[model samples]
Target: METVDLVVPVKSLTAAKSRLRGAADHGVGDPKAHARLALALVLDTVTAALAARRVRRLLVITSDPTVSLEVAAVGVPVAPDTPGGGLNPALERGAHLLRQNDPCAAVGALQADLPALRPAELDAAIERAAAIFAAGPAPRAYCADAAGEGTTLLLCAPGSALQPCFGTDSAAHHERSGAYPLQGDWPGLRRDVDTGEDLRRAADLGVGPRTREVLAPCPHP
Candidate 1:
């Protein structure tokens, strides 16, 4: 079982989760409150990733110094989004750094808003990805988001190009780019909080302590 280097990209707190603002009247109307929720989500995601036994290294790429400080509290190294392109570019930069440090290490990009992510679920997904990598021919693979339309996780074997296409309909895009879709019953791995509805679903599935603490004050409609 080869260790995986996981790259997580987070936007500035003020710019995070804009689409989730008024979703289902979740009471995250205040900008400050929204930033707090966003940070909490990232904290939980990083916490789960750190707990995953298969993840040898976890790197967070972001331009926000505030986010860097927060992630550092959890012992995860933060890298500046020097590429400054977007989500994909940030991921590429992190992957590049990991490869430079250890060219033979497998690298993968994971979404940063998965408050409901479980360590066991992430380990399972990585195990499946490792199997695919070992099978040969296919060098990359992705796990669909909860909606089954977007990509929540994307991986490339060591020395392989990590072509991350994470955006609208990203699942289709990654598949088109030769990344196999992993099939499994990994509910936590699939759940990436975006809209208000998605947040509610994650709440139902049980979120991490950080997310639960932040959402406790805000009443959902």
Candidate 2:
């Protein structure tokens, strides 16, 4: 199976994870704490994605200086979110750049909030997608979020355009756009944290160390 170059888009901390604001152990109205949680989620997600054997390179798209710095420290390239529109546009920019660098490599867009991501699960999903691609003319494939409504991962084979439609009901949107749906038993790959409850579910799945650090209680003054 051909390896993939994954593009992860992260919103600036100031505007990221709004729904998580009042979540227990996730800041609860504290802006600074909220940003830390947001950053932790992205870092964990990136770390796991990079560890996947099927992943050749990972690029993080964001305009936040702190995010750029943190991700760069891990040896992942950072690109500015030039479009400044929304998720899809940022993903498109990342995908375009990756394709420009190596047109033969598959390009994938992954959500930045999957703090519990497991590299093996991601590799299995990508392998499944590769099998489907080899069998037919399908150019794209997507893995649904845990709720089966949103899309957590969208992939396009070499020379295929990654026309992502990631938003509400994005799983269905990607299907309507002709992307095949991958049926992989990957709980960690699907669990993306959005609300307090989502965080709880991810915790149940055993989040990465970075996320665990953020969720750990602060020391008494």
Candidate 3:
């Protein structure tokens, strides 16, 4: 079995998904505490990736100095963004870094906020992607977000040409563009912390030790 390298794209803490502005309920926290909480969760993402047996290496892509230092503290390599402001370009930079280092390695793109994602689930997804790549000649393929709109996990064929389109409605768009759908692995991987509602949904699934520390009880059914 070929080893997989997982790269997580972490948005800057000060400029993350702030459109859904709201207060955090993590008990003792500041008004901007959610941002810090989000960072904490992202750190855990690397931990989960490192725990997966199928992964040969785990890297985090970000521009935030604090995040970069913090992630490195846990022994995960990080590639800081040089010229990307948004998610798509940020991921592109990560891809560039990976290609520069290991041009032939199979790469997986996972969001940095899925604190509930387990190591087993990640192994399964990577295994499935490796199987698909070996099975056919599909040049471009990836998995969509939880609601199936956002792009949570994307896998590239080893040494094959690939493109990323992980914006809103990414699920349908990826399908229309011929990417296969992955199901029944880890629901937490798809559930990104974008809004209050999203937080509630993640809380319902019961997250891991990393997420449990930063998040307060979410208010939703």
Which candidate ranks first by lDDT, i.e. highest? 2
TM, every model: 0.95, 0.95, 0.87
Model 1 scores a TM of 0.95
Per-residue alpha-carbon lDDT of candidate 1 for residues 1-221, written as tens digits (9 for 90 to 100): 47799999999988888977754236537777778788888999999999999999999999888899999988999999864588888898899898886888899999999989999988898889889888985889999998889988998888888999999999999999999999888888899988888888899889899888877765462
- The digit string of per-residue lDDT tens for model 2 on 7-98 reads 99988998998998855343457888888889999999999999999999899999999999999999999999874588888898899899
Candidate 3, residue 155: how far the Cα is off, in Å: 0.3
Q: Write the per-residue lDDT of candidate 3 for residues 1-221, one digit (tens) a residue.
A: 37777778887787775743443553443546767667767877788888989888877888888888988998988887765467677676677677787898777678887877778888887777777778884645676777767777777777864466777788787678777777655787777778767766777876666566655453441
**Clashing residue pairs in candidate 3, if any?**
none
- Model 1 is weakest, by summed lDDT over 10 consecutive residues, at 21-30
* Selected candidate, larger lDDT, 1 vs 2: 2
What's model 2's overall lDDT? Answer: 0.89
State the C-alpha lDDT per candidate.
Answer: 0.87, 0.89, 0.72
Q: What does candidate 1 score in Cα RMSD to the true structure?
A: 1.7
lDDT of 1 at 120: 91
Error of 1 at 138 (Å): 0.7
